[model samples]
Target chain A: MTAGPVLKGAADRVLAAPAAPRRKGHPGAYLRWLLLFAGGLIMVAPLVWMLSASFKFSYELYDLNLIPVEPTLRNYEKVLGDPRFLRWFGNSFLIATIVTMSNLFFDSLVGYTLCKFRFPGRTLIFIAILSTLMIPTEMLVIPWYVMSQKFGWLDSYWGIMFPGMMTAFGTFLMKQFFESVPDDFLEAARIDGLNEFQIWWSVAMPLVRPALAALAIFVFLGNWTAFLWPLIVTNSVEMYTIPVGLKTFAVEQNVDWEMVMTGAAIATLPTLVIFLIFQRFIIRGVVMAGLKG
Target chain B: MADLALHGLTKTFGKTKVLHGIDLAVQDGEFVVFVGPSGCGKSTTLRIIAGLEDATAGTVEIGGRVVNNLEPKDRDIAMVFQNYALYPHMTVRKNIGFGLRTSRLSRAEKAARIAEVAGVLGMTDLLDRRPSQLSGGQRQRVAIGRAMVRDPKVFLFDEPLSNLDAQLRTQMRLEIKKLHKQVGTTIIFVTHDQVEAMTLADRIVIMKDGVIQQVGTPSEVFNAPANVFVARFIGAPAMNLLPGSWREGGVALDMGGQIALPGRQLADGTRVDLGIRPTDLAISADGAGQITGAITLVEPLGAESMLYIDAGGVEIIAACPGRTAPDPGQQIRLSADPEALHLFDATTGEALR
Candidate 1:
């Protein structure tokens, strides 16, 4: 008997020959490209605006104009010529550098301890340290301020740098990263006659460079852009960081819009440069930490 | 090379006991394999030997010296992990030379030793590549190479081949055997796979529930198991057990059948288990056999066929050669060779003869 109509119909669909399109489809493809272009523009508009404002003259800022009417180097000149601006920039650079390096070294120290060593109260210590991450900085602000005053640290660089140096989040991030590493690696190194310090320094540290870099970027960015803490502690203009100094420039009477934007632009540059350099490591570390946690 | 011994070894984690008074000895240049199911303390025993774990109450001796307080590095033993823990950041050459470099060895000597190990492991071409760049087998080879560079007195392998595919595992198993022959270092291997234990071990130690059930040569363990746990564990298509009792002149099966016994003189009314290997079961066409069975399932494996038969109220497996694909639901008579049969006391699970 011949095959049924249903089976024959399925066979015909399965074995159908290729056919040319009845209508042109280029418009749909172009429309998709247009939507993508619009999305890109929307995401990049703020950055373009910031760059444009950084170059505009003081009179051109209030015109609500996208393009600068008079793009001059006068704002940059004013910002660079101010001695306070240079001092603030130097202070910010030094603090961020110190905090970043200390965090990288010290957090890994504690991270490796928590990860490998089986000391008494290890879990308790880890939980205590990790709990610090949940406490908001704002909640601790008053107590920290009073403590800094008691230490006679207000208006000093230590008041700002010391508190920002060691962070619970950095230690937590590093501990999680170190835990993902196989225990055998450490045991193998130990069997190689390497001491505990040597294992942490040579083997564990090298393997965790990516995580360290990500943490460095995070700490540096946080320290560089820190406003509230620095603002509270630094009363003198000499010890002011860029963020605090920028606020001073904006609040002064007859504020130069161009100069303020230049100061803001300068403050944003270091973070941008750091992020651009270590963006891949930053993304990888974030994804790894997310997966591990 | 050196011999090692464990004396009254025992371990406990909090309230739970893991290893219960285990004692063993390994001669120099001999390979001992610990085979058991998971949570049987085989890996724990190996770790204790490696000084990676502290035994609760035991003394471990390596090279005739007690190493209970010694660190792993001081124990003079090298271990190859199941995960092949090669340092992912370092190249193969550096990974092999790390231990030497950390010691008092000079730079030149370290390089020479690395080169020698690379040559031995056939890893000269992969020396410049990192661990992440190598395949699983290559990484395992690098791990072995790292252990070789140490030239320790004893080597411990914790299921090193469990991570590889079946084909690669067999090839690596043979390589490890050859390596043992060449190096002549005492080796302690841990694996749950009976095939691996059977193939590579000079002596196999079988364990159950953290206790050493038996230790003997491969043939001894296979031919004469110490207990029912071992008899059931050592062989494939496990030994068949028939419930029976000693009668006046023979053993009577629960199904009202009887097999004539020699003058062994088992106590009357003693409960016993008759054990027989599948290969010992002969197919007979005559109805005069001791047991009759119906073939319920047949698995033809080209070289040999396995028949699952229902006989004497128990299902039994019979291995037959020569492509004999018996049809399902067919009647068959099975009788064990009188000389090949095994007798065991039912209560103690110990061999009767």
Candidate 2:
């Protein structure tokens, strides 16, 4: 008796070797890299120009050159010698720090409550918060100005800091991140004998560190460069933040290109420091939120 | 250690009742397991005892004190969740010691206790590793170690071993049993696997839908199941049931045979379903047995082979020696002792004593 031809054919087919691998690096891949590089250069050109102008003499300001022929520190000296420049820097740092801290505390607390706790009107409250996100910041400025004036908060740090103390976007981000921290962890923490606030502070909060870092860095940068509201609200140079003060300095000096560029270059330092400190968290948070969305 | 009791416990989630008035009393230091299929409310009952969930009605007593209103932290209980819920940011040692952060124990005492638990779980070398760095079984051990570090009045395990692979599940089941012996703490475990329930439980609580069908020792539940569901559920390969009607001294099987039940006093013509375990039916050599049928298929399980026999239109499974199982299409005679037969009501599916 012989093994059948059909069985032999199937065995031969099953034992056959695999096909060759595909080649790498097609033309479309090179095109994509070229396009991305061009887009990056376009985005970074203005920053390079500003740094170069700050170093060059005022005669070379309009040369369209990225690198300075003879870099000088005189513009920095003139900008720093102005006492009000330091005061404005201090004010901006103080308000940004306070606002970021407030947002971190209030936003995460509200987010935790909204996400973890089951109660009546939760969806309604969340919708209300979400609705506020649709309204532009320009539209809220008037109402905020009226409320600040009614409460005698004009020309004060509180007036500028209150609008951003707890943002709808931050709350939404925190809530989304909190969704990833399982209810099992919270229940286990409870069974482990931690109170509700402690559980939120220790167990829930630590798990959303990425979101918190993203929110902190975002809020700090937003407030650091804030101009419209602060300019409108503060009547004295003593109370002005960096952006408002720099605008006034430019106008007073009749657009001294070197001086203005020097101040702008120096003003970018804190934000650069912040980005360096939390760059990884920001990227991860964006990817996480993007995937979730 | 504490004796826990639930009096008329029920849970409702937005009008869908998950537990229907569960009432059970567990002795101090006893190991009780709740076994049921998914969505059967076994885990809900366990959570209510742990104070992770609030019962819709009734009170939970821990060591004779009502804990219905207490928070989970104040309930003096600990739970091992199914996913092992270890904090990803913390080391195994830190995860175990997290429960002691609010304790009145001195820092040194807490460290000593965590070290002791790690030693008990044979995980001292893995203590510095995070949960993300550990394997499934190792993470399960860390979860158990975390619960052990607390030394609470009662330990609630909600399908803790379900996450492990088959071999690891058996190993962890034995480890849990050994841990229970060493600590002698009151434990309430929940699982869907009947084998886990049978091997590790002092008393198994069998549940269906939202109600407990029976509560008994492993031997008792296996020997005399409370209903047809339990009869089919507790054994491997399940008990084979044949629909039939009862006569005074015998059951007229729906497939055309009579089984003489010598001691039953069932009413004549009562509709019933007769059940017999595959292991209880043996092949007869002389071809004169209570039932005879043609073999349809044979399943080899190493030591024993299961023969699927078709008698009339009904298919029945019987276990025979693996080396000597008759080939398919052969006629075989199988005999079962009368005492081994179980009779259940055809309509209600409840067993008839």
Candidate 3:
């Protein structure tokens, strides 16, 4: 007997010839792309406007025009010629560099400890450090101020830089990455006659590059753009980081909008360059840490 | 080359005791394979011997010196990890040379040793490549090369071939045996695959439930299994056991059968299990035999066929010629030579001659 109609129909579909346009059935596909494009443009428009304002005359700041009618180098020249601006730039560079180096060293040490070592209360210690990530920086400012006052560190670089030289999020990120390195390698390293510290430096550290890059970028950016703590702790212009110094454009009577925009624009260059250089590592680190860790 | 010995080795994690007390000895240059199921403490025993894990009680001796308190490097042994454990950032040359970092050898000597190891592994052309660039077998060879480069007194392999595919595993298994012969270092290898243990080991140490059941050469274990566990565990498809009790003339099987005992004897009315391999239980050419059953199923393995027959109350496995594959529901009479049967004390699961 011949096969039923439904079976024959299924067989025909299963054995159909190749090279045919398969299917497309979703609705509003082009509209989704359009809406996404609009959302991205909205997010990027402020930066574009800040760049445009950096090159504009003070009178052109209020308008919605992206390209200034009179784009001039006068504001840039003013920003570059001021020794106060150069000092603020140097302050930001030094503080960010110091904080990044310290965070990379201390956070990785703490992370390797929590990940590999079998010390008692390891999980408790890790939880304690990670719980610090939940504490809002705004809430910790009073205690920090009291401590700084007791240490006579107000208006100094120490008060502004000490609170953020190491972080909990960095330790957590590094621990997540270090867990993927095999325990066998560490045992092998021990048999090879390297001490624990040397093993951490030579064998374990090289395997977690993505986390290092992510942590370095994070620590550098966090310190460079710290406005509230730096503003509260430092009164003099000599110790003001870039973010705190950018606020100095607000004088008592009126604000110099062109100079502020110029400073803010210049302050953003290093972060943008860092992001561009390590874009692959940052994206892959976030993806790997989120999905696997 | 050195002798390795474990004396009264016992391990306990908190209140859970893993290894009760294990004592074993290995001759110099002997390839000893620890074969067991997972959680049988074979890996733990090996780790204790390597000094990676401190024994809770007992002493490990290498070259007749107590090494229980010594560090792994101080104990003069090297291990090939199951995952190969090569540093992903380093080339094969650097990875192999990493073990010599603390050695007092000159740079030229370290280079020569690394090159010699790479030559032995036949991976000299691939020395510059990272582990990520090599195949699974090549990574295994690099691990072995790193172990061999040290020329240590002993080598510990922790299931090093468990990661490869079937065909690659076979190929690597042969190469590892040849490497063992060439170097002649005392190697303690651990694997769960009995075929690997049988083919590669000079002596196989079989373990179960954190205890060694038997230790013998392949022929000894195959010919005379110490107990039921070893009897069933050493061979494929396992040995078939038919429970029976003693009779006046011979051992009367549980269901309505009796097989003559040629030379072995047991007390009357004693309960026992008759252990017979599938190959020894022949399907009789004539229809009549001691045990008559109908073929319930057949497995065609090309070279031989396995028959599952119900010989009264119990179902059993028997083998037949491949080309004469039996059909299901066909009547069959199965029997084994009296000399080929293994009788075990049914209660203790111990062999009875």
Instruction: List iRMS for all predictions.
Output: 17.6, 16.3, 16.5
Q: Which stretches of candidate 1 lie over 4 Å from their true place?
A: A1-49, A149-156, A288-293, B248-250, B261-263
For candidate 1, the docking band is acceptable
Q: Locate the minimum summed-lDDT window of 10 residues in model 3 chain A.
A: A1-10
- Number of the candidate with higher lDDT, 1 or 2: 2
Chain A TM-scores of all predicted models? 0.83, 0.88, 0.88
- What is the clash count of model 3? 0
Candidate 2, position A193, lDDT: 84
Rank all candidate structures by their DockQ, best first, as comma-separated numbers.
Answer: 2, 3, 1
Query: Candidate 2's residue-wise lDDT over B130-197, tens digit each?
Result: 88789999999999888999899999999999888999999999999999999999999999999999
* RMSD in Å for model 3: 7.5
- List, residue by residue over A23-95, the lDDT tens digit for candidate 3: 4454565676689999999999888988999999989889989999999989989998989999999999998
DockQ of each: 0.27, 0.33, 0.32
